[model samples]
Target: MNSERDALTEILAWRRHGDPNISAVEAPVVKMVVFAVGDTLFAFPGASVTEILPMTTIYWVPGCPSSLEGVINVRGDVTSVIRLGDLLGVEHVTEDGRTAILLGHGNAMCSGLRVDRVLDVLDVLEERIQPPLSTLPERFQPWATGMFAYQGRSVLALDLGRLFQDYRAGLA
Candidate 1:
């Protein structure tokens, strides 16, 4: 009975004062802005996404490439919108209530990425991100950095740097 009491007292004391030698290790988490282009889902680093704008009038530029959806006025700023589906060769989704513009800024430029819909904004553990699937589309493979699951659906994380770089080259 005494030994049992002593063990119980020790456990209570340990609970009151956790071991100082045990250092807490926090898992690295990446905040992401997830959106859908057609039936596929994609995400960008939250830090790169400056804003999420609602679907609005896009003033088309006559000479711009097909990937260039058009431009929109945000407050007083005019931001160019890139149709991700056109660039990545995904099935095109017409502009509708679910569409959104993710305003992302890269090293050299900033543009609004038009997506079919905005699915989620979430923090995903770094370890949760796995290498992209081999079956990924060729155009999409170049921009996909990693893949992770969100709400039972796999979401691909895109490399904003490479995407912007390619977009710049396409314009030239």
Candidate 2:
């Protein structure tokens, strides 16, 4: 048993490739939180998201745009909520109890994004994320990052920074 313990390092070295230039570092991966806004799927970088909260009572704000779903009280902090479908022109479906609020902070602002459901939290190889296609819808093209497929669904990765910037500037 002592001899076998001493041979562990040698066994590891034996598994290495002959090429010294190639290190054994694992592939880079990007963690994402995937969610749906209506039937359209979207994702946000995990680093940008602070927390996830269940759908709660939203206090309506008068004179705001339709996309602004009002605000919610989270741990005594007032967080404004937005509907991605209203901003993107995606169809809105009736809430079916799986809805959630993703608390995300972008470059310019922080808000709660109302999503239909949080489908998954994934760590995907960076290479698996593909650039947005030229045929992407005009509304999404502006705010989207690369996209990737997960579990038979095509999920569009969005840049929360840009979206927040635009939202602050009254673009959304």
Candidate 3:
């Protein structure tokens, strides 16, 4: 069994470094704005994110969705912070509060998102996106536009607009 495992590892290493004919040309890197919701990591197209603000107390509004945590003052401007997990109906992200991700969707209205932490900016390519499987949880399906293999893990690419637009429309 040990020998078989060693052989498999050797073959994989060879395929990664020695297979010149099977080179997968690297994709043009685009910035990925990363954030954490609970322990899971996620990202949006960096261009879509305008700013990340520290966790601050919010002013609650009546008759809003449970996912809409509340509004925070961003440099004198009030912006609502959406609880990312609540919007997706993710139970693990049941923690009630987080920092704000002030996002502007291509000149559309700007809003804030409550996230656990903001990870570093990463660069990935369009070709790196893999289709989301139908087997994903129903709650997660609407938000996960696609998945990307970054480093050794599969990172879900979020559809920020899906979460943002409907809420903004409500305010209009």
Best model per TM-score: 2
Candidate 3, position 78, lDDT: 86
Clashing pairs in 2: none
Which ten contiguous residues of candidate 3 have the minimum total lDDT? 91-100
How does residue 89 of candidate 1 score in lDDT?
82
lDDT of model 3 at position 153: 64
**Candidate 3 residue runs with Cα over 4 Å from true position:** 1-26, 92-107, 168-172
lDDT of each: 0.87, 0.88, 0.72
* Deviation (Å) of 37 in candidate 3: 1.0
By TM-score, the better pick of 1 and 3 is 1
Count of clashing residue pairs in every prediction: 0, 0, 0
Alpha-carbon RMSD of each model: 6.1, 4.3, 9.3
Candidate 2 local Cα displacement, residue 162, angstroms: 0.4
On residues 24-100, what C-alpha lDDT tens digit does candidate 3 reach at each position?
77668778877777766678888888887777878899998877778888788887777776766644343445544
TM-score of 3: 0.71
